[model samples]
Target: MGKEIDSTITFQNLSQKNMSFEQVFQHIITFMKKDPSGNFRLMFGTDSQVFNHYTKFITGIVIQQERKGVWACIRKVTVPRQMLNLHERISYETTLTEEVVSMFTKDHKEQLINIVIPHIYKGANFTIEGHIDIGSGKKNKTRVFVKEMVSRLESIGLKPKIKPESFVASSYANRFTK
Candidate 1:
């Protein structure tokens, strides 16, 4: 089992006040089941912000239906600061993402893909991808980590995305960490 991280998820369009993990899972499942013809994509990503004494990490899950926009849930956690280099920071972000994806997929594997329509393949079916907050370019300190991060994600059968394409982590989750 991976380290248990506490999370609070807000289901945008739903009227529910507070939702448990199971409830969120059910909500997503029901949403997919209700629209069997809609194209769907599930993405998971994490981003972190460092403060003088601690670091804040935010992880997000996005469920998108073709042209219908998206519904997402975010979890934020703050921990004592550690002197981590750029590589370490990116590595930690990726690890947190892996843990969240693994936890979700462990029990929801079948449910995640069972409802996809056979002919509506506009994007990935049920694959959970990781969006790292790193980019290419010699001036970017994190650039050297792109290959390593991608390989790490690939080792666990996950697709990886970096800057320019990794808006989920660099943009979406980054918003909450600040």
Candidate 2:
């Protein structure tokens, strides 16, 4: 829902900067091509931090090859004022992840899938996960919205993960929300 979802937006990781979304897509495809036999999880997640004046939201896109390596990049959006409500922040985070997910058209996903289909019987697998920065544990304050958030992601065809298992949101993207 923010400008970061636009075609002109840029995504960056440690070794790169100002990379267009197309470049990011190509990067993932190239990584998979390098090891088509590896299990890949293409995940999207967002985390936010409420600064004094604004909330900094960061959405991460990661292509992880189990027991191997990963290629990840993040897009950022900053709201003009601090977002104090817990539900609002969590919902906004999901919205941000959805925005990034919408960028990968059907053809783009097919391209990635085609690369691994040949190696499927060889242990190669692919899954798309939506990681929400909320937990279902009783002690977790975000537990209340877990169902809603998970359902939102599931409606988009993604397997949803949360809390301890949602490393992309709870760990990766969170680091930059500061």
Candidate 3:
């Protein structure tokens, strides 16, 4: 049922004009046959960015048919920090100045997360430093990467978080898949 309704609506209609990302989102929920009827949702990014770009992240959405409407949304799950860490961590170098590391140790962190993924709301947030745990698989690959990302985020006066970013990413992923 959900699939059938979704098939009838072109993704473009959900995000073609200057409608704020929220407006387009509303159209999607409404057209998809919402029971409670909520055609308005707002996110802090472009609809195209959030949607239309999930394959890049290797994620997908799964829509579960509710008794009368669609689900809240769910996506292929993974480690919040792992996902935000980005593959770039694989080639990161760990040579932070003692002063820089010390400064950060005293400050908070930011995290980068993927928001609405599969459906077309490919979202990402960068705050709360994603604690990188270089698994025993590699030498110092992950260690270096985490150090680099932290330095980069600090350079921009930002921090990293894992929870929010992960939640957003999975939510979008589920929506896109649906």
Candidate 4:
């Protein structure tokens, strides 16, 4: 948000927009791939608690677990084509831990968070960065790639256990661009 005379130049919220769910999921997956160091554990939860909580939360909504365990949980979540948020995003990467990680992941349980995280970042424009790929390419084509991947998943009847709800304007994560 920026001040422009009496009014402020604001970033638009596209949460209620029309879009594909695949693109959103892809972003999250890409980010997870970058989690080679395990720092991402903070984003989801302590160890595997996020997965368990995810199953419990969406149990009756998108899934009905025949059996449950600690290793993994089968649950359903909304995978929208796109989304938008109108709040200020907070810096929460290394600072995150088990407690808040559990809450954020659960709180925004419905969105395809981290799906396209490789591209939609907080400081993408102001930095030189390292050898980045995928997200930095033709961004408009982002949706095309995502949908194709989703089509493949659907073909295998593989539900990722995570889904995001779409909107009319921007394609966002579970809630804020966390």
CA lDDT, every prediction?
0.74, 0.94, 0.28, 0.22
Q: Which 10-residue window of candidate 2 scores lowest in summed lDDT?
A: 1-10
Q: What is the full ranking by lDDT, best candidate first?
A: 2, 1, 3, 4
Q: For model 1, state the Cα shift of residue 113 in Å.
A: 0.7
Off by over 4 Å in 2: 1-5
Higher-scoring candidate on lDDT, 2 or 3: 2
Q: Total clashes, candidate 2?
A: 0
- Residue-by-residue lDDT tens digits, candidate 4, 57-129: 1111111111221111112232232212111011111012112222223223333333324444532211100
Query: Compared with the true structure, what per-residue lDDT tens digits does model 1 show for residues 29-80?
Result: 8777766667776777889988899888888777777787777777665779
Model 3 RMSD in Å is: 16.4
Q: What TM-score does model 3 achieve against the real structure?
A: 0.24
Model 1 worst lDDT window (10 residues)? 5-14
Runs in model 1 deviating more than 4 A are: 1-18, 82-84, 117-125
Can you give the TM-score per candidate against the true fold? 0.81, 0.96, 0.24, 0.17
2 or 4, greater by lDDT? 2
Q: Is candidate 3 or candidate 4 better by lDDT?
A: 3
For candidate 3, lDDT tens digit of each residue in 1-178? 1112222222222325233323433543443333222222211110011123232221211122223333222112122333223344222211111212222222111110122222233231122222222332345443434455455545644332222343323344334433
RMSD versus native structure for model 2: 2.7
